[model samples]
Target: MKQWKLGLVVVLGISGLFSGRAIAAEEIILRYGILERTVAVSDLSQLAETGEATSQLQSYFDTAEVPAEEVQNMLNSDVTVDGVNINRILDNPLGDVLLDEVSKSIYPESGSAGRQAMRAALVLSAVDDDRITVIEVLENYPTSRVVLDTERLAETYEDFQEVGGVVVTVEDTLDDVLNVIRILETLSN
Candidate 1:
C-alpha cells in the first residue's frame, strides 16, 4: 500500500510539471510597427523581465536588409561640426534616431550620400513631429505601463539644430536598434 501511494504521488508530480509548461505556452499579442503578432506568453514575459530576450527580437529586424555597404560607411565615418562629434553636441537623447536613419539606408540605390541624406530628412521631419515624451516606465509582472509627457511632445520641435550634424555608429546589434524603436514607439503612443 505504501509503495503504491508513493508511485501515485510521483506520477502526479510529473504530470503537474508538464501541465505547468503547457500553461506557459499560452499565446499573447504583441505589436510591432503596424503588425500584430501572437507570440507565446512565456516568450513575452521573458522579454519583459530579462535582458537576454534581445536576441529573439533582433532576429526579427534583420529582415529589413539595410545594406552592408551603408552600414560599413556610416560606422567608419564621423559626424562632426567644428571638429566635435555631432553626437557630443546632442548629448544622446536623439542619438538612436540619428543612427537608425543613417545606418539603415539601402545604399547605392538611395544615392551616394543617401544615408547622410536620410539622416538629414529624419532630423527635419522631427521638427514638426508631435510624438509624446516618456515620463515613467513601469513593469508589473505580465503587464507593463509607460507614462508620457504628452503636452511637451505636442509643442513644436525647436531642438532640431542640436541633432543636425550627428554621427552614428553601428556598435549596437540590429535587434537592439529595433528594440529601442519599438519601445520608443510604444511609449509615444
Candidate 2:
C-alpha cells in the first residue's frame, strides 16, 4: 500500500507540472533600413528585467548592416570629410553638394569602421539642405537631438550661456537628421 501511494503521488506531481499554463507571446514588427522583421517575444517584462532587450535589438541592427555603436559614435562626434569640416559646411549654401561629394569618397568596405564612416558620410549628405543649416534645424526642433543622443550633446562650451542656448535650439532638429540617416542607410544597399 505504501509503495502504491508513493507511485500515485509521483505520477500526479509530474502531470501537474506539465499542465501549468503556457507563456503567452506577442509578435512585434521592427523596421531597420530596408529590412523588416517580425519577432515573437514570450515575455517582454522578463526580457526587459533581464536587460536582454538591448542584445536582441543589437542583433536586429546588425542584420540591417547598421552597426548601432558606429551610428552612436558618428552622431556624438564632430565629423569632417574630405578636408571640409561638416559644421562649417552646414551653414554654407553649397553644403548639400559638398556633403554628397564627401559621401562618395567614403571607403566602400565591410568592416565596422568603414561601414560607420560610410553611414556618417551619408548622414551628413542627407542633412545638407539649402533652406537651413544643421545647427538651425536643431535649434528649430528642441527634442529631436535627444532621440539620437539620449545623454544629449557631450561637448562643453567655454561660454555656457550662449553655447548652451545653441545646443538647446538644435535639439529640436535631431529627428530630421536621424530620419535622413535612416533613409540613406536604407538606400545604400
Scored by lDDT, the top model is 2
* Residue-wise C-alpha lDDT for candidate 1, range 83-145, written one tens digit per residue: 112223233546545443333321212134433333332322222221111110101111221
Q: Where in model 2 is the C-alpha error above 4 Å?
A: 1-33, 36-56, 65-67, 80-92, 96-189
Model 2 residue 33 distance off true place after TM-score fit, in angstroms: 4.9
Clashes of 1: 1
Model 2, span 9-48: residue lDDT tens: 3443454346451211133334443555554432223333
TM accuracy, model 2: 0.22
lDDT of 2 at 164: 29
Model 2 superposed RMSD (Cα): 24.9
Q: Where does the lowest 10-residue lDDT sum fall in candidate 2?
A: 142-151
Q: Evaluate model 2: give its lDDT.
A: 0.35
User: Model 1: residues >4 Å from true position, as ranges?
Assistant: 1-25, 54-56, 61-189
What is the C-alpha local distance difference test score of each model?
Answer: 0.32, 0.35
